[model samples]
Target: MEAPAYQRIAATFRGRIATGVLRPGDQLPTEHDLADQFGVARQTVRAGLGVLVGEGLIVARRPRGYFVREREHMVYRPQEKSRPRPAVPEMDRFSEQIAATGRTPSYSIEVALIEAGADLAERLRLDPSATVVARRRVRYINGEPTNINDSHFPIDLVRDSEIMLPAYLARGTDRVLAELGYAQHRAIDEIFVRMPTPDEVHRLGLGPGTPVAVHFDTGYTESGRPVQCAVNVLPGDRHRIVFERHWS
Candidate 1:
């Protein structure tokens, strides 16, 4: 079957972008010109361009033309969290990694006492209605929002601790847990791929058709008690998760 005109137009631009002919920030032809080239109406040109916009390949600038999107992706290794922190000043793994790449890392954190939802309750081994300390953070690189990391802990475990405070933890929450006598000895990481929710779109400034990976990291104390559960939401186009294994 013949592809639609809009699809052909979209494909032409997609190919150019993929092949580097349309580099990031390079402007697309004006809608009128695109319409003339495609022998279609302006609305058809818009439809075609909208496909690229939704795919995170291009963006529209009001009073200007559409341009290829520019993005800086970070490689994420879930296994690194288990490794010892480098001998350096107080900084979380996220901060350390981004800083190593010569990019500034920052975060917005909010702490609250909230009831454990079903998923969190199961992970934390608490009743669904039980209170938990929720430490919500939106991580950024070079001032652009990157991902969301919200950690939940049993209120009793973190009560009166720094984790309950709405502030940056230079040493990270894991260290705070160690100080609280609940040092984690093991953790399980689960990742799920799906489309972003409306709220996620707003928070991450995601374009249409952008998907995300929801990561659940549950940490267990030395005695095998669940102490903390962190949910990290990573934008698919902005991150690459890596894992390593050694068969002993």
Candidate 2:
């Protein structure tokens, strides 16, 4: 039996995209044009285009037409946090990584005192309703929003510290905590792959077929007291999460 008309139509464009015959921002032939070329109804052409849209291969612009999607992926390593930061005091780990790749990294931060929700409370070993300091940052690369990093710390542990102020800390929070006698000796990182929440979709400006990887990093002091919990949101289409292992 012959393949469905829509599949054949979709395959034609998919092949063209794969071969770079159709580059990003290149608009596809209109539904009427495709229907005429394939000798099919307009609905069939729409169904075919729908497949590409659902696959993140293309996007539809109502007033104009569909265009190939552009993608730029960033490498994200969870283990980087455990490594020592750059010797230069001018930049943090994120900035150092991006700068090494010739990309500029910038961020906006907001600090608030919020009631500890279930997830954060558990990670921080605090009562669910207890107050915690939330330090949120949206990292941008080349002036485009890249990822979200929102960290929560026990109020009693971080109150009045730079962690509670919405400003850049030349020395990261870890060092600040060390000065406060709660140095983190170890950390646990957990990751979950799922669809983005409505807020996340808006924050990241994500499109259809774009999922996200939610990472939770919990830090502990030498005495095993939980001191900080950070929730990092990485958009699937734009981030590649990596981990390395060693055997002793």
Candidate 3:
């Protein structure tokens, strides 16, 4: 089946942005103008604009119309053993990774705790009521929120470690894990795309009908014990996860 008209318009505008035809901060044509040009209803134009806004490609101001936004590119490097992994500083690794690629990184920690839960148990390979540390964070690039991460760690493994402390007072989880004697030697990652949940829609500032990519990462020690499980949700339009494989 053919794609919807609103999607076509969104694609067309996205192409323009990608090609630099519509530079950052450039105001998009009025809704009526876009509707006339695309021979679609104003609602269609609004929907297309909403897609761009949700993707962090544009911003809308009351009585001012939509304007193109500055875009940031993300770099992804697979977790490697031979390759040197830096100590996790006192901040979210997701933000650190984004900043390393020349984009400003920002995020908010929603929850952090040592608790017992079914989700943590399943991922940690422990009993259903086993205690674990849970953390939730929302990451932003530039000024737009882009990713949500929920992480779990076995309590006995990191209860006294720095990862449990505030970012300012402690080193990050990766560094803390190294210090706790469970240095991560490798990681397994799973990626899938789907529509946003109601909570995700509000948390990620997504508009109606936007899909997101979910990444589940499991980190392990050299001894093959699972140390961390993280679930990351990224907006489909704002970020793309790249995987590179090299054979020995």
Each model's backbone clash number = 0, 0, 1
Clashing pairs in 2: none
Candidate 3, 64-157: lDDT as tens digits: 8988875444544435322554554444456566677787877676446655567556666888777777777777788778878777888889
| Cand. 1 Cα-lDDT | 0.91
lDDT of 1 by residue, 52-155 (tens): 88887888888898989876668989888888875554788889889999999999999989999899999998999999999999999999899999999999
Error of 2 at 131 (Å): 1.1
The local lDDT score (0 to 100) that residue 54 gets in candidate 3 is 75
lDDT for residue 40 in candidate 2, whole number 0-100: 98
> Over the full model, what C-alpha lDDT does candidate 3 score relative to the true structure?
0.75
Per-residue lDDT value at 18 in model 3:
92
Residue 165 shift from truth in candidate 2, angstroms? 0.6
User: Which regions of candidate 2 fall more than 4 Å away from where they truly are?
Assistant: 1-4, 11-27, 61-64, 86-88
Query: TM-score, each model?
Result: 0.92, 0.88, 0.68
Residue pairs of candidate 3 with colliding backbone atoms: 89-172
